[model samples]
Target: MLHTDAPGNTRQNGRWSSIVLIVKMLLTVAWRNLLRNRRRSVIVFISIVVGITAVMFNDGLSIGMISQMLENSIGSHVSHIQIHAKGFNDNRVIQNNMATPSEVENVLRDTPGIAHWSPRVVSFGLLSSALNSSGGVIVGVDPEREQDVTTIRRSIVEGSYLTGAPREVVIARRLADKLQVGLGDKVVGMASALSGDVGSDLFRVTGIFETVSSEFDKAYMFTSIDNARSMLELEDRVLEYAVIVRDINEVEDIAASLRSKLGDEYEVLTYIDLLPILVSQVDMYQSMMYVVYLIIALAMIFGIINTMLMSVFERIQEFGVLMAIGMRVRRIFLMVLLEAGMLGVLGTAVGLLLGSGLLLLFSHIGIDFSIFSEGLTSFGVGAVIYPRLTPDTILNVLIIIPLTTVLGAVYPAVRAMRLQPVAAIRYV
Candidate 1:
């Protein structure tokens, strides 16, 4: 018999091997079985969809809410990056650090990967309007370019961005309200230098800017860096550096790179670093997302295991017949697993659709939490929460849903395959 067998056919024979063919056959069988019980398949589909929708939308909205607040906090006043005097971070007092606008501007303009650069001077002072005076912080910025980097463009509610060092300024809506001044009002900014030699005498109100973060919105005043320099008696110098980048994703990369390149002489800080609370918050959300996915995956696994067990009990004769017809018990077990896998695939698809739908809807209209702002004062989170969408979160759900379903079916599948042929065949 060996002598008669074709001599060079082994390589060709291996191409049509039993295991490969078995998988194909098993998948086909699983598909047929699934279609045989359309109602059950549909139930599993609905469960997966519900789970995914809740997870995706809840996370998305949560992200958006935080993103909105962060934008208001970071984007409006703080540029993406700030280079300051090495020891100045601990004491952000105005006099301790200074950079010349034109000097820094020349270096920044030539620096690759930067979008825009600005020299800013920050000071805490008393803002006196025509009739009333309110305490606030004064922020000196370039009027025209301020719009390019932040949410400031939409925040000017009453008048206009300061123009041409008009002694003109933009105050927060809260400060404007507290000061009882609207458009075309003059406010005095009073800040004394460390030696009491330099101080802000006065400024005219050009506009009132509104934002979700009342802290910055109420206290901040925008003026031309020139006007700010003049008022503070700071000629040709700035308190710190403000830089924007090409993308938000590159923040940490840029921060790290800047730290290395700029070295220890200057402190390079990202907008995220400037506000530690927000960075901590985003980290907390990410940690919680992991826990959520784990819980949801375990729950989904249980659902799948239960469904598969039910199917095994319901189809004992089918297994007996397969065994009786010479189909290996291992193949029978594998087929059951394939069925579970198929369910997972279908469920994942449905979940993604529902999750995407929820994301789209929330992205547009926003989730309003304005009614709860008073209570939220405790957490420092705004009352109206917005959910933002990102690819990482979406990818998480994509990886989890099917993995849960497949893992859940493992035990039940093994039990089904191990059934004694006589017992399974004798089931009444």
Candidate 2:
């Protein structure tokens, strides 16, 4: 009220002398009002809590999703780098003219950045059971060297992985079901070339693997390179050579380096290039998260604005009394702003604490998608997605909540400043 002495009041003489007490007094009144109407305060509390909860849920799922994508990127699909026949992509066929595998292996071995290397031949064929059949792609890999290339070893659910020669095969459970084949069963696999010569081979189903991915589970078979070459009649030739670097995340750089060195003689692919589906998904998820965050921030802003506006209306009589003595409208504005600021700061503190506790609890127990097992699988997500809370969420919530509250309250605080002393007195 800018140092105004009201009646016998002598606590004020100048703006700075009275500013501290006026702020303190406004806060005391606002807090008391907040407590006086517990129901409305509870509604505000719930609005903020729900808003934070939505943020936590979306953020946690996105984290888990990205983590799974990274794991899958490293585990099964593309190793850090891939070397393929130059025209292998355009024709989408493996050629017999492969570089001496030993020469390539030696180079990869001596390469400082390369940590793990594996040779593989990819082929496509229709797998047939007695009553059913399905077309799927197959990979011929060295079982002993496969572990270093893929976590397929860990995903083996039944029977040992096929090793040695070309008679055994490992298949995902989905393909096994389509062909009505199981461990130890003989499944006839047929492969054809761009030329007319074709061959059908019998493979004993040696192992069954189960991963949460329906796409993988549905259509891939694993065998030794010898089997793949024997069926295709291409000896001493490989379709592609896959490699893992010291750091999987550096795949794009590694691929670029390989491409720069090798030129067009070979095609180098990275995990990023291998699974473009995840790249698109990651982008979409990030965009959606930002949208949800903005909506929640706006909701919090409105709650604070409504409360501050009501406080300004209720205090009109008191403000008028101060103004009648000598208080300036600008001073009244600052006092209201200070009160709104206090509420914003306090509310943010409480909201953050509540949200942190809830996030911690969810992180420990984990938000299970098991209840939506069928739904998640239909969408290609695993049934168990652990909730992860990063420092980013906490920082965003803390910053956004208070900042939005103060921004929203500014309008009401401005309106209070425009009120004249006589008009405000008659406003009640």
Candidate 3:
């Protein structure tokens, strides 16, 4: 071999080494330039910090609201999944009930992820007290099983939960108020029986429960499955089955499994399906955040541009001297860009630290917005909100802040590059 390629490799390595040295020099010069204008740099740095912190805190509040809504809705009544007769979700009539309930019960029992399941006789009816009458949905449940799947027992504000006693009913606080009834008050429930006639029964109000939702409170009444069966003239059939799973994150998989096992006769629905509006709200929130990020980025871009432009104007003569001594125009441009990059990197790092700290603190202590309690309750959310720092929000900030700073530096960097060395050096 001639070994001629050895010189070529050596020259390539030398060129790469030269590039690295030039980069190191440019970084040092950029850093020194930033230090020369500490006040302006600090001002821009503080703006970024404040902006990032505000955005993070706002996003955290939204996440907390959506999380609370989901928890309250699921804990109150929806459960993790619901199994209904094929037409029951749409029609919800006495005729549209599960005929062979034993098979569904068996599947629920054998399913590994199912924690608890409760059967319900759901029917629309008129509930009347001695004082007044109101229309609501009647839910017949097994007292003990319902306790495991729903928070109705814990939500009892007054009186007692169902004890398998005959004709005992649990009414919501709003319904109670509407009917001018309280615990122990006698109420009449009327519904359409399977015999093509109206069926009616007398019940004693045993408990009054108040959840976060006023609508849910006013719209539903709970009674023993036996009493409901007796009044409705039904056999051992059920209209719906509410199921709770061991883990909520696995609900979609569990629902799919249940659907496969149960076949087409039954409808397997998850909380996501039951509460579509809430799911939409969560998605809408994420979409709306992009608009918020745009606003913040725009503000940051302008701030960086004003600061960097001022720095460039002040250093016009200095740039002229460097270029006069044979510094390339591209090197001047790269130096300006490096200065902006430094600002972005430093500001973003500090901002993330402070923002993340605040999120962690609020996640533990929570923020009280009880002043808006009435409004929050209407949406099935709690008064206290715990801020969470999600990975997506952090990733967006890490990308946006630095990109905004660099984009802002473009005009100033170009202006520095266009300087005529002789004319700039002679300027006052």
Top candidate by lDDT: 3
lDDT string, candidate 2, 1-428, tens digits = 75486655764458876777666776676567667667766676566666776677678767776666556655765676778877775566655335566656666666667878788878777888787999987788877877788877777899987676567998888899998888889888887742447766889898988766677678888888788778777677778788888876676777777777666777787766766777777788778877888988787777878977887787787788878988777767766666556556666677677666776777677667788866655445567776667887778877876677668778887888877888888876
lDDT of 1 by residue, 118-138 (tens): 677777778887778877888
TM-scores for every candidate against the unseen true structure: 0.87, 0.83, 0.91
lDDT of 3 by residue, 29-124 (tens): 999989898898889888988999899888888887888898889988899999998977788789988888899999999889899999999889
Best by TM-score: 3
lDDT, each prediction: 0.76, 0.74, 0.90
Residue runs of model 3 more than 4 Å from their true location after superposition = 1-17
TM-score of 3: 0.91
Q: What are the runs in model 1 whose C-alpha is more than 4 Å off? A: 1-16, 129-133, 252-264, 361-389
Ranking by TM-score: 3, 1, 2
Which has the better lDDT: candidate 2, or candidate 3? 3
Off by over 4 Å in 2: 1-39, 110-115, 193-196, 246-248, 321-350, 353-365
Q: What CA RMSD would you report for each candidate?
A: 4.2, 4.5, 4.4
User: Residue 364 error for model 2, in Å?
Assistant: 5.7
